[model samples]
Each structure stands twice: as structure tokens, then as C-alpha cells.
Target: MPDDFAPTPTTLTTADGLSLEAQWAVPLKHRAKVVVAHPHPQHGGNMHSLVVSTLFAHLIGSDCAVLRFNFRGVGRSEGEHDFGEGEQLDVRAAVDSLAQSGDAQCPLVLAGWSFGADLALTCDAPELAGWFLVAPPLRVLGDERFKAAPDPRPKWLAIPERDQFNPPDQAQVAIADWTNAEIHPISGADHFLVGRTDKLNALIDSFLSAL
Candidate 1:
């Protein structure tokens, strides 16, 4: 039903009165949804970043509603960046906003690229059906100080062939605890999947399709 969908711009205020700017490329007929998180806000990441936007654009015509939002201090969202702390709260707020759109049992997916992926794992909303993390900083999220990943989750980690942020050897050890987590390497792609979008899109599509 979503063969030719166009995303609609949206904004929602969280319980804390912070205004979040978002983009929703909802399916033409389906009501299920997915919320995407952006990269680290402190490093110039926002909802419009190339990788995040690509993820949003890749799923525009999918069966699930796709949501992408800017965190506090990033883009139109108010306040300064909290590194990962406030951003995690922002991600949960986005999840709650999407949950309120339909039945409580509606299927929901959470995806983040880079540091955003780490934030996605911070959201433990019981309503989420799955998670898709692209080029995540596994060590950063693994630190007990940041917080543990969502419980017993179904996750997909798309790592670039040569991501300098999280070394390949380190990633292998970091992903060991995730029972449903699977990691795939994109050949010749940088940490951001630079000039290899077609492969990135194909990988993302296959993951969602499997669900």
C-alpha cells in the first residue's frame, strides 16, 4: 500500500514541554510504526543528517509508519545537548507519542544510526516489537554509566566494512550478549555508509521485510 509515499512534517510536545520536530512517512493504509533516532547531537547530528534521512527515505513506502525527530537543542528542538542522557528521554517521548496514535498493542520498531542507535537501545518501551541499529557505538552504550540495552530484544546491527568509531574486533565482543542481535557488514562503506547508500537501503529493507 505504500508504494509511493511522501513523508509529512510533524511536531509534538513531550511531557516536559520540550517541542520536538519530526518527519512521518506513514504507510498509505497501515497503522503500525517505527521511530528512528538521529546521531549524537553534540557532534552536529540531527534528524536531517544524511544517514538518518536516508533511513527515513528508505522506509517511506513501507508497511510501517516511519518517524524521525530531532532531539533537544538539535535543529528545532529546544535546549542544549545532554550528550546521551536527555536524548534518551527524547527517544522515549517519541515512542510514547507514536504509541498514542493507535492501539496499545500496535507493532512498533525502533531504529537508530550511529550514536542514535545507541539511544534507540535506551528506550525499553514494552510496546516496541523490534530494533534496528546501524553502525552503533557498542562500547559507548555498553558502559554501565550510560545504561544497559533494552531487555532480550530482537535487534539488527548494520556495521560498515571499516567503521573506525567501533573497531570490528571490539564490535564482535560488544554484541555477544544480545540473543536476537545480528550484525552485517556493508562492504567498502565507511562508518556513515558514505557512497554506498544502495547497499544500506537494501540491508534496511531486508530487515524490516523479515519482520
Candidate 2:
């Protein structure tokens, strides 16, 4: 039930004792809980940001629980940006909190947008069911790790054809190493895919189905 969903806001604390705010939505019954990542905090990114919010709404149907949180230094999260170093830690910690609390083998999905995509590739969680990345900046990713990432966990890259930040030609080269990875191109959209909520939801639904 990863379509026709809903959202709920909640808060959780980091290992360093800082408070991080998030939108936590679940189906009527317990399902897989997704740990979502946001874009760069310095660039006005938060859980409520347009694309991230749209994704969370799509994942919280009758079979899943979606958690979209503000990374360190954004919104209610205490502390400042770690240039992706500490941010990866924050994502891992969020995953740990959920796993340690008894959510395991529930098809954990790691998803992010733009900057969030770059940072999420740096994680090393074996339990991760998939990586959902949109508008990832190749330069920001800084290496071939994303390319060489093992295929037991698949990857989904969403790129807007007209995205000023990441064009098709560039995305083609960046997505070279992903075996199961599929990059969906959208027409007439920017990096944020403005005015395309319905399309985004459909794409997210398809991803959930494959899992």
C-alpha cells in the first residue's frame, strides 16, 4: 500500500542529544518504516521541502511507515552542517534508532533528493533495500562509489530532462555503473520538478511496487 498515503509530523533525538524534527506517517497497520533524507540543509532544505514532502506522502499508505527528518542544523535539528560528513552519521543514527527499537527486515528504503542523494550514497548499510536518488550532482558525489555500489540493493535515479543542475547527457555518464538502477527522465521540469506532484507520486508508487 505505497500509494494513496498520508503524513504525520514527529520528533526524534540524535546521539549527540540534539532534537531532530520529522514527518512520521504509517499505514493503518504497522508496515516497513522508511528513513528519508533531505537535501542540503544550508540550501534551505528540510523535511517539508517540496519534493521530499511529496515523496513521503507517496510512501505512507497501507503497507509502510515513512520518516522524513531534518538533517543536522536544519529547522529544529540542533548543530550546524557537517558538509555531509556528520550528515551521513545523522542518517545512520536515524536508521539505528529504528532498527534497535525493533524494526528489522522491513524493506528499509533510503531516499533523498539532490544533495541528499549525494550524501546517501556514502552510507554502508547492508539492510538498506534500495537507494532512491533524484538530481544527484556528480561532482558532489566525488567518486565512483555510487557507480560501483553492489546490486543486491537496487538504485533509482530520477532526473528531470530540463534540469539546469543535472541534464540528461551528464546523468547518463554518472549512472554508468548501476546494474539495476533506472533513471526516469521527466519532461519540462527543473531540478525540483516544479508543478509535477502527480507524476512524482506515480514514480514513487512504481518504486515501492518493485520492492
Candidate 3:
């Protein structure tokens, strides 16, 4: 609730000409700028999702400027869902929004949850410094679509041990050949990560520190 952490509601324009609803917060000083994407829009995901909001709450401080937004069709935003296809543009718009709102010299990191995680893997913008994925199903699109797999940028995956969609073991096989990527398992956590937010946040903290 502090003044520096207060989020300012904003809007983003995607390349294809859609206005997306968003909110961003910048601290008095920051080392990194982050854009957070929520889970599947068709499945009730939005900028206020627990994990997405957690990242917003945890990251917007003296060290980071954070932005969380609803995908094209999720909230007050315009345009319909495009599965994982057009959503990529939505992510790009978010990155663009944050880039213009914060310190351009600071590292830009993409943090996403579930379906949003898969979207993060598909974004190959040159501005991205790193990525943090939480319990990504990895089945939303296809392996060929994950542009970040071969990318050398730092990536951290928080795979839930008992995830209904993609467990730690399956996740391991999926990222076997990925470059500069690491997986941190959330023991006893399912895909929803009911009570494992603390563990997840810890991993985020570590990721931010490393950057």
C-alpha cells in the first residue's frame, strides 16, 4: 500500500490493433523490470490471478518495477482469445509497455503462470533478459513453438511435483535439451500450487537476485 508500490491502471495496444487492459507499478528505484502474464483466459485467468498478483506484490519494490495485465480477451481488454497464437502479440505488447514505463537499461524479465508460462517460452524478444515459468503445462502449443528453449538467456522453471498437467518428471523430459534453463521443483504442489506460493516466491527471489 505504500506510494512507491501503488499500481497505475493503464492500457496497451497490441500490434494487430487491440487495446489490452493493464496495470503497472514502479518503485523509487529499481534494478529490473518485469511483465507478468496470467494463466489461461478461457479458464478464468486474468491479471489478478493469485500467482500473477503474487509476482506483482513481491516484485514491485526498491529492486523491481512490475506490470501485470489481462490477455486480449480476459478482462476489459479488447479482442478474443487466440489460444496460444495471437496471445504472443499480447505478451509482446506487455513487454513494450513495461519497457517504455520503466528503466530501459534495467533487465527485462517475463514471469508467467500455467498457460502464461507456455506463452513466455514462445516470446523471443531481444529485450528479454530472462524468464521465470511457474507450473507450465507445456502442452498448450507444441515443442516447435517454444522459441526460448534454444535461447541462451537465463530461464527458470518451477515445476510442481504433483502437477496434474505437467509433473516434474514430464517437465524434465520436455526441457532436456534446453540451453541455460533450470527447473526447481515445488514438492507436494499440484498444478494449482494451493499452498506452495512461499516456495514459488522464494524461487522468484533467487531468480531476481541472480539477474
Candidate 4:
């Protein structure tokens, strides 16, 4: 399916009563379901971040039900940003919204980019089938979560070869203890993935296709 697969705009209510703005598309077959988290709201990150947008557009018409949303305090979402802490509830709200759609039992995948990646890792959800983290800045975020209670679920780390924060070599070292993790280095790309979205989509598609 193409990127313009027509999304339905909606609102998600978090456990804490905050409402988040969201968009989603569900496939007929529903082979997989995915909840995509945007980058840091402190920056220009939102559900519209290129990486999150690209993933939403690419996965929409496929067998995956995709949901992307703005965190609290971003765009039309309610409440102020609690940094990454409250954002975790936003992620869970997205997952809950996706689950309310067709085939709630479908294998769910949690995918995030940059700051969103950190939130995905920190979110206290164990029902996810796997995780796809793109250009995560591991140097500054939750490293103990993976170390203290390393999840065995498959995790795909799509790192930019020249990432400004987490380079491929450093990423390898950081995720070494993540027993089921695999790193795929995107050639000639940066942390933002400015002009290499096709490559990023391919890497993510390949990872999900394998499962």
C-alpha cells in the first residue's frame, strides 16, 4: 500500500483522563497490529514526524492496523507534557485504541522513532509481540529497563550509520544484553533520516515480514 492510504482521525483517552489526538488505518486481514509512537514533544516531534508518518503511511494498507498519535501537550492532544513519563500512557492509549479495532488478538508490534523509541522501551507493556526502534538515542535514556529485565521479544534496532546520538557501533554495545535484539544499520543516513525514508520503510517492513 502507498503512503496516502487515507487515515481516520480520532481521539484516545489515556488512563489518566488526558485525551490525545490520533489517526489510524486498519487492514481487512489484520495479520498484524502496530502502535507507532512519535519522537520527543520537547522538539518538533509529534505523530507527524517523518519517520512515524512514513511508517503509518507504509503500513496502513498492508495487513497491519496502524495507529499514530501526538503525545500530551502536542497539537490537539490534552494536558501538558510530562516529558517521557506521561507519554508512556499515551503510547498505551494508542495500543488500547488499536486493540479496540478489528482482531484485538492480532500480534501487536510497538514501533517508535528517536525519543519515541525510548518511550516504547520504557512503557510497561509486556503484550507486544516485538519492538522496532528507529534511530534511538540510547546514550541519554532508559538503559536499565533493558538490562534489569531484558525482554526476550524480538527487537529490531534500525540505526543510522552516522547517527548523531547513537552510532551503529555504540548501539551494538548498548543493546548487547538484549538477547533477542538485532541491529540493522541504515547506510548514509542520519538521526532524522532526512532523505532516506524508503530505506527506513524497507528495513521495518523486512523485520515485520519475518515475523
Q: Largest lDDT belongs to which candidate?
A: 3
**lDDT per residue (tens digit) for residues 1-211 in model 4:** 5344467898999999998999888756677888998888888899998999998888885667889999999999999988677777888888777777878678788889998888788754756778888988864355764421277778899999899999999989887767788989999999999898899788877877887
Please provide, for model 3 over 31-108, each residue's C-alpha lDDT reduced to its tens digit, 9 standing for 90 to 100: 889899999998899999988987788787547899888998888999899999999999999988888776778899
Worst 10 residues of 4 by lDDT: 140-149
TM-score of every candidate: 0.88, 0.84, 0.96, 0.92
lDDT, model 1:
0.76
Candidate 1 vs 3: which has more lDDT? 3
lDDT of 1 by residue, 1-211 (tens): 3443567788867666788888776554554577888887777888988888877776765555778999888888887777676677788888888777644555788888888888887777877878888888865454553233436757877888889887556677886765677778878887878898788778777776677
Candidate 4 global lDDT: 0.82
lDDT of each: 0.76, 0.72, 0.90, 0.82
- Candidate 4 local Cα displacement, residue 118, angstroms: 0.6
lDDT of 4 at 79: 97
Candidate 2 is scored at a TM of: 0.84
Residue 110's lDDT in candidate 2:
78
What count of clashes does model 3 give? 0
Clash number for each model = 0, 0, 0, 0
- Higher-scoring candidate on TM-score, 2 or 3: 3
Point to the candidate with the largest TM-score.
3
